[model samples]
Target: MKLVRPLPAYLVQRYHGWKATTFAENKSWYRRLAEDGQHPRAMVISCCDSRVHVTSIFGADQGEFFIHRNIANLVPPYRPDGDYHGTSAAVEYAVTSLKVAHLVVLGHSGCGGVRGCFDMCSGHAPELEEETSFIGRWMELLRPGYERTAGCEGTEQRLRALEQQAVIISLENLLTFPFVRAAVEEESLTLHGLWNDIGSGGLEQYDPESDDFLPI
Candidate 1:
């Protein structure tokens, strides 16, 4: 017998109904999106964690934000790659092509990527030495955070400190991009740092006021 996905009939019907409206009957909504160039108001850099989908947190519509996701949500210092700079390419496009007015780095609580980078720094993950590719190269952006917060009192405290520091690193990297920095200098762009606490269902903004995260 072929395997079948177990489903409640009502849920199946509702799901199909919504899918039809979102994709079939409502296909024009998406068609128009592609037809018209995307003009999102913000460019958000976030982690690839499934738990921290920023769109769900913000109730964003189809084209409200341009998104870039990477391990621990890093933004590398800009350099001439001689070719493709995947994350940096997204940043350039968002600032130059899309011209989004806001650039945001969305960090999250309990980020596994940050912990892995920290562990790699500790020689806990010896396999890191063998992997001389994308992950190894990318994790460079978070090393400063791992080093800075390693001495924090507890595991949770260390993680929070590292997470916050990672956000700042990304902000600095964003400034290294010529287009992004130009936009900021010209007063056409502003940047924000967000910490999403998944367990608490709370969003925190970096309160420059007290230099802490505060509920948004």
Candidate 2:
């Protein structure tokens, strides 16, 4: 039952090339990070899309950001029922232990997970609606957002709205954590919502004051 496999030849060679070039050039920096331990200034929770590059987007170095990638960048509500919560665990560590100053929930355009959820909720993707489907269960978190966006006239508009809703919902759920709420209220931590347009190469930030995603 070996579910995992080794890297292919091409990827292995590419990794070694990167190690020689990038790692070799930053050997001292990497060593220092290992020795001192990581103290990232921000915690980024983004989608598992290969196109959404957080490091490149922020021009951040290795030890600058603690990132967590999950489907649709969705954050479930605070449920302390002794279940395995991977995203919650990361949020707990980043907020409580790492004391990251900023917690960013990054969503993006052309997200397959979002599209799948949209289809599932709309009765188009019956497979995802099954109880045995992990994606369907995980996507339940976005159902509220779907409700809001489902009224849109066009399919494209609905999907895009749902993408932004994912960011908004995640930001709301982040506050459900007591530590997260306390940190924000005391000014130790700030929460940010960002949506990236994959095709247009544009970044829009959610503004609580105006309740809109304004371009940055």
The RMSD of every model to the true structure, in order and in angstroms, is: 4.4, 1.2
Q: Judged by lDDT, which candidate is best?
A: 2
Q: Candidate 1 has which clashing residue pairs, if any? A: none
TM-score of each: 0.86, 0.97
| Leading candidate by TM-score | 2
How many clashes show up per model? 0, 0
lDDT of 1 by residue, 107-202 (tens): 998988888777777788766545565665567678887788767998778888888888888888889888888899999999899998889998
Candidate 2, which segments miss by more than 4 Å at Cα?
Answer: 1-4
lDDT for 34 in candidate 2 is: 92
TM-score of 1: 0.86
Evaluate all candidate structures by whole-model CA lDDT and list the values in order. Answer: 0.85, 0.95
